[model samples]
Target: MYQGYLKYKTVIAELDSAIQLRINIVLFLASVYLVLQTSVGFKNPTYGGAPKRLPEKINCSASNRGFI
Candidate 1:
């Protein structure tokens, strides 16, 4: 595998800048689409049938001072 990579290293380096930019743009768009899908899933109430419940007591104690 190392030898194969070494052989193609120069070929990879010689790729046109325009091609690299297009590849990068495609990857960025893909990541953005994935994030949007995830956020939409979270916001869609139809996905999770049950609503989450909050705890009755709120704890804002200082752990370092041994308070709870």
Candidate 2:
């Protein structure tokens, strides 16, 4: 408010505090989402499946090929 700003510096300080609170809220939500995803992401079937393989474990021979 123009009246508040002209009278004292408290108005600007209050606005700055409100802005910081909003920013802190956003950051907290983002951090919570990141932690949740990181924890749940490991439980996904794609991650737990046997797709994680080494080149040596694969059988690339003709007999092992399917409809190739």
Candidate 3:
């Protein structure tokens, strides 16, 4: 009975360690993804630009009006 209990404890300890390692890995991946997303967003202007297409004349007018 004592030996069985010891085996069970060892298994539980291993499972706990594995779970902690997995959680750490997931958090690291999430942090990496967030950093990559932020870098991409800042480097790519289209990510924050208008979604609709504007006419060239309107763009020129806006530029002339100092709204650009």
Q: How many angstroms is residue 1 displaced in model 1 relative to the true structure, after the best TM-score fit?
A: 36
Tens-digit lDDT string for candidate 1 (1-68):
99999879867776766688999999999988777766665667554434557677755569745773
Task: For each of the candidates, give the backbone clash count.
Answer: 0, 0, 0
**Best of the candidates, lDDT:** 3
Q: What lDDT does candidate 3 reach at residue 30?
A: 90
Off by over 4 Å in 2: 1-8, 42-56, 61-68
Q: Each candidate's TM vs. the true structure?
A: 0.39, 0.55, 0.60
What is the C-alpha local distance difference test score of candidate 3? 0.78
The alpha-carbon deviation from the true structure for residue 62 of candidate 2, after best TM-score superposition, in angstroms, is 5.4
What pairs collide in candidate 3?
A: none
Query: Candidate 1: worst 10 consecutive residues by lDDT?
Result: 43-52
Per lDDT, what order, best first?
A: 3, 2, 1
Q: What's the lDDT of the predicted structure labeled candidate 2?
A: 0.74
Q: What is residue 15's positional error in candidate 1, in angstroms?
A: 6.2
The runs of at least 3 residues in candidate 1 whose Cα sits more than 4 Å from the true structure, single-residue gaps closed, are 1-15, 42-68
Better of 1 and 2 by TM-score: 2
